[model samples]
Target: MAALEPERAKLDTTIPNESRIADYFLGGKDNFAADRAAAEHALTIAPELPALSREGRRFLRRAVRFLAGEAGIRQFVDIGCGLPTQGNVHEIAHSVAPDARVVYVDHDPMTVVHGQALLQDNERTVVIEADARDPAALLTHPGLTSVIDLDRPVAILLFAVLHCVPDDDLATHIVTHLRKAIAPGSYLALSHPVSDLCPEKTAKLAAVYQAQGTITGGRRGNLRTKAEVERFFDGLDLVEPGVVYTPLWRPGEETPHRPDATWVVGGVGRKPRRPREHPALT
Candidate 1:
């Protein structure tokens, strides 16, 4: 694989980025004290955040395995892919399908740089510095174009990233555009932070992220109701046991049950060969 070098010198270590902070929560050594402090503050507001992160990660692994092994998905476009952690999308996907191709997209310089470094020897993977809000940019990137065949079935991974998108319409637009770009049989695996699970505590953490100059901006984290999340997949065919808590989304092993308000919701939907046209699309 050719090296896709990023301008790493431009990385700003002063500010706490979502990717690095997430790395902190995952118990990785790539984060700084500032990131750790912000993560700790976030925990103060929502004590189960670390656990939520773990569950979310687990959900991602399970989803990717299903997509590659069971769903016969060979291509993956992971948007808002944070810093490379254990059981990353590419690793899990390739484990089942050795030929599976993955394109990771994120605007964070650190994530792009580190991901590129980690994926250097993997010709089947590519990392592009692109924001999830701009699906066009991501779709048109050389790296994405090189790895993902848009006209074929692909799994679009939006795991734990929609919270960064505050504009409801833009969030919808991003998914709509990407869905249009892919052929039928494509899949969308999404996991988002939900305030309904722990409204007060989640809101408090949202405030901390806002104060930390993080991209989340205290913008309510777009913590949607379960029905609203279902709205995002209006035209797609939802998989079995649809739109449940992250741990409950096809939990392979028996997971310890938490309170009803667990702060995260996840689901996978398949783009039918003939999906109903939505009024919103017109």
Candidate 2:
């Protein structure tokens, strides 16, 4: 049988897309041959890639639920949102708050195209093609503001996406930029792969991604330690159980176990109502 066309989206199926690779990791069938190859290549080194990806998704679900239900947030902006799959940010948020609005942003054209098609009928949500590195542009997009009100408390989600920004300075700038742009009481929830638990494995995994391309796109490893990853949340007030292993962040029912099981670390930070000058969350 021949390979099927990428629906109507003009996607370069030849090159491995980060979203497609993540889709493959999440056991989805929307990936191309290139994505499977890249994923298989990484699997040889880190067999836990799939598990790590699923754990990261779990963290996203938990965080979004918290923001919508417990945190009383009504607007959500999910940057670097990959392929639209089950239990997306909008779905999770809507479950808790029917009136909650969500804006899903992804630089990948394929993701944007596919998400737009999938969400065309969902009035409360909209997906836009935008780069996460430029938070100001995306945050200010009419498409985002159409659904999200930046004036009030909105949750900005960066789940399993920041590691793609290998440049330390640029990564910090992105977070800081977003922190500055959002109004007071807004929240930033992020989950990043950490190297503190398994330095050797994580480094090799980073090299695998670094070899693949400029953006080491993966949620399992990025060669940064817990401390380094924590810098992204600087200045903002971290919520309870700040920056811990994914499973330990807010695990349901079951007792959280080994940190190595979930090498990825996650946390949710909020901007105070009266910042002593509105510092950047660098």
Where model 2 places Cα greater than 4 Å from the true spot, the runs are: 1-10, 214-222, 254-258
Query: Which candidate ranks first by lDDT, i.e. highest?
Result: 2
Tens-digit lDDT track of model 2 for 1-282: 112122322467877777889999998988888889999988998898888888788889889999999999999999889998878999999999999998999887889988999999999999997777666788888999888878888898999888877667667778888887778899999998878777887788787776765253223345778898888787789999999998988888745646667789999999888765645632
Model 1 misplaced stretches (Cα beyond 4 Å):
1-10, 216-218, 254-261, 280-282
CA lDDT of every candidate: 0.79, 0.82
Model 1 clash pairs? 197-261
Q: What TM-score do all the candidates reach, one by one? A: 0.91, 0.91
- Look at candidate 1 and tell me the lDDT of residue 166: 52
Q: What would the per-residue lDDT of candidate 1 be over residues 132-207, giving only the tens digit for each residue? A: 6667877998888888888899999999887766556777788788777778899999998876765666666666
